[model samples]
Target chain A: MRLWRWIVCLMPGLLSAGEWSGYAELQGRYFPQDAAYENQSDHLISLAFQPEYYQRWDKGNQSLLVVPFFRWDSEDKERTHADIRELIWTYAGNRWEAQAGIGKVFWGVTEALHLVDTINQTDLVENPDGEQKLGQPLIKLSLERDWGILDFYTLIGFRERTFPGEEGRLRSHPPVDQDHAEYESDREERHLDFALRWSHYIGDWDIGLAHFNGTSRDPLFIPRISNRGEIKLMPYYEQMRQTSLDLQATKGDWLWKLEAIHRSIDSGSYNAATGGFEYTLVGIADTDMDLGLLGEYLYDDRGDEATTPFQNDIFVGFRLTANDVDGSELLAGVIKDMDESSWMFNLEASRRIGSDWKTSAQIRLWSDIAEQDPLYSMRRDDYAELTLTRFF
Target chain B: MKLSLILATLLLTPAVTLAMTAEERGLEIAKEVDSRDTGFHDFKASMTMLLKNRHGEESLRDMRNQTLEVEGDGDKTLVVFDEPRDVKGTALLSFSHKVGDDDQWLYLPALKRVKRIASRNKSGPFMGSEFAYEDISSQEVEKYTYKFIEESEHDGIASYLVERYPVDPNSGYTRQQMWVDKARYIPIKIDYYDRKNVLLKTLVFRGYQQYLDQYWRADEMFMENHQTGKSTLLTWKQYDFRSGLTDADFNKNSLKRAR
Candidate 1:
């Protein structure tokens, strides 16, 4: 089935008047865990086939790009699936432009928090116990100008609640299992966000700033609600208020970024809920800074009971460029969880295989130092996994 | 016979000594080359790249077969790629304002769709090569600040060397040094620099052919990466200007209609 799609994509360029382009990657990995858990590893294969067609209008004064894409992943525990990555239509004139589509809307600068780093079609938040949560659908719009860009988006039917053990189910579970049917089902509540991003180059620096509000589809959550309230049955829809500020600076090969997020939630429900405003700060530094070191620090002032111990984290890493190639890069880093006092070390290497092909491999090992606490005892299951991937 | 020979030599010496300064002559030659090539055109080219790793492993790859049609003071270009099965039929349409901004579009085959390539990505490498998207685009004289370096002889040909600095902040090249043939006013070589003003790559041109009597084109061009040890060679088979092609030929409708 996959092979046929690729052939069909190539046919337009070969047999008709359209063009086609695509890329593919295959990767295998092995995992070794300490005595606490069984060692397990899996191989992954991912492919993206994209083909676009352009139709010129009005004496070559304007044109439109109709690009659709299909992707597949072998390691998807749910099932092997294919869907569009970017389906956007653009109308461009001399000075004005408009686009409408469902594509990856990259709005942030931090690599881990909001930089659109995840390659998986679905958004997954990996918990300490290795569980994953999926993402939601979004409708995006944008207007660009010579000075900067103005963008707005709203995820109309935000549904993150999945069945407890039905890994392959795409539909919602019974109402008995959900506290709020409107929020849990894929038909109620709207996650709206708007941002104004400005980018300017001054001397050798590429500076950018952005301001946004709303809940992020990813797991980089900021705390909301103060510790002063003692109520129950919190409204899930009211927990979605968040404001984010992001700043990034790049000079030469170095990059520095800082993000501060504030959230206000109606936390009057649940035993651990404190209802006020919470703030989190995160900072990231990359090899472009100095000596090929990449590091990050994050802090949340929402109290130890409300925020996870790993919420306060500091890590440093190094990136080495291959001597023979321009884009090949190797990155290694060790992160220390300030709250749990645990540590994680990771190494990744990537190279451009061909004009459109990319290959990469990564290995990660984690350990917990605060084993005295029962909650942190799982840290003893330190493990490592090596993954090899190819991108088409 | 000796007296006649001395007189002839003396006369030619003064004539040679009346030449312009190196800086003045270099600028004049650079302008001449730019003027001769300023027009809407169509081109088809193929490229091959040889890539080597740090441990001496080598691989040969066919990069791309590309066709470009330009219009409107060269501010807009319709580019098509026709090799490497994956992107064999991909087309890119770029529109640039004379004074303000530029927009780009890419048509993919699988989805039967067209996507807008974000403009902010102009600084990113093109297909992971040392060259950025902007590097492959047509360059306007107003985009750079030029200074005459010197007059030098290269490969037995007298050339004028000129230094050029990018006027746009988003440009990947901080500076470039171009060697122009003195008589033909055609660029034969160029050295590209990074943001730090360090030499990053060198491009060499050969197989020059005269077109339209006044225009000169290089049939072969090679870009060598000093840092990566990789090189790409481009060979142009056909280049036609004012071939009665119009804006209608470069539109999105023509993309699916391209051969």
Candidate 2:
């Protein structure tokens, strides 16, 4: 922690031409369904702010970045929190580059599920799309060549996943006991993780292979009896070894993507895959607009016993871009289970208002959720959200 | 292919004996333009884009652009956005080809992933501005077939009018007419026609400056959408040519590090 303080103290003078940029957002959510948790409200408001500073020295290709984010919820106590999203130093050489400190890295190509993207801990409280992640502390080096890009990582200070508070809509029936979460690795939260990836592009195809060792980002749960006679889910993180592959083939207006992973945890070894394609129709109806159609298949080897939500399911979505000066766009999708005919529908629309302002509307719904589903408790949390963001 | 045909025609009908059609003369003018601006190698510049609605509402964006000249093929370009906090640190890498489809990719900093954009989207607006991907692309002579329209005076300046049709089937414009300055041989103004043969937009180039005593560039470009009552103004800054850039600097991996 001393090193973090030292970097932050000196971050303001990293370069002469550095810049500061970020955004502040205000959101209002409305739930039409009955309250899924006690004392939960149908209407809620949230405020978030993120501040960032970046500096890049032209000499030796050195750079520094610092980003701190915080969220404040009106009702949920646990939902309000603060985090340092990024604080990294980077240096680029003629052939190799190195980066150290807290940052984020992503890997995967599929849309429905991210099978191989597990570098950073999931920031589950951020949104329903599962796209936001917390900063991870690590040291990384990469070598660039004609063959491919080879990268090595030394990960440290593992972060635990965050969940919605008990008073939030997306919470599980029995609150997840994060404070008492246990770890299978003897090193606990200080576990030292290691990872590597080799990526290359050949003609129209981009492929990557990766491997990771140490603690798994996802946790396994056990039902424990509390002192109040209430059942709570005890979160447990196990030592894990994961190997994965991601690929994308771009040809004309069609893009085919695939992500597959095989991992071994405390219970056993499992395999999962997500494959999909995106086809776009440009200038639809003689208007300067684009419509993208997406289809994907997600499968888990655990079948009915799988803890993951996506198992033998189909995901279909469409992305419409108005291509106007305001950058208006709409994305809607549905995930349907093959066996039970259960489903979840989502819609997200956003557009720029002026130079520095943006507005968005979001919707989430569930229907006919079966008991066999891993997240069946969230069926009653159907809600919609509206947000306005100001950029600087 | 057009070059070979021009050569064959030149051999059959002697240039000294005349009999050069407008097509041949138009090809000659294009060749001249290419000849004069051939060896820039690579260049980088800062750009400011201003978007204005018909009501005079304005918005601005800051960006950095770099381009590398390929020997026998089309140019490679990279654009990194620095302003507008929502899109800050977003970079676009484009490899323009002489024939068929060009390759393009977008790097989203927040997502930390590089996505290959559909080439068919080249005709769509770029970043919600009046300039489409095709409009901003490095205009190589091979991408268009040209016909000499007439010699005329445009904007009180002597210019040669020419009509060109995009070779790419996915281009949004059915045809375009350009007025090239007689003195500089650089395009000074352009008129675009939509797919339905309706006038869609007009682009004007101003503040022409020469660099390295060999290359001509415009410091300001304004594009107006006639049907939508929208317009965009792009001001070029810090135009530095031949900065020792290579193909290695324009690859997909470099996009993530562009910031």
Query: Best by lDDT, which number?
Result: 2
Q: State in Å the error of residue A308, model 2.
A: 0.7
What is candidate 1's local distance difference test score?
0.49
The docking category that best describes candidate 2 is medium
Candidate 1, TM-score vs. the true structure?
A: 0.58
RMSD of each: 11.1, 4.1
Model 2 spans > 4 angstroms off:
A1-17, A58-60, A227-229, B1-17
Per residue, candidate 1 scores C-alpha lDDT tens digits across A1-392 of 99999567445444434333345444343434433322212333445454545555443333344545444544433334334445444444433344455444433344333322121123321222222223324444444454544445554334432221122111112111223332322333454444444543332223345444444332322223324441212223333345445554443334566555555544421111111111111111311211255666755565453434435567576766542233476778776767676777667776654445555666666566565322343343333333333333
Tens-place lDDT digits, model 1, residues B100-124: 3355556664333444433533455
iRMSD of all candidate structures: 9.9, 1.5
Model 1 chain B: weakest 10-residue lDDT segment is: B60-69
Q: What are the Cα lDDT values of the candidates?
A: 0.49, 0.87
Tell the DockQ for candidate 2. 0.62
Residue A386: error of model 2 in Å?
1.2
Measured with C-alpha atoms, the lDDT of residue B59 in candidate 1 is 45
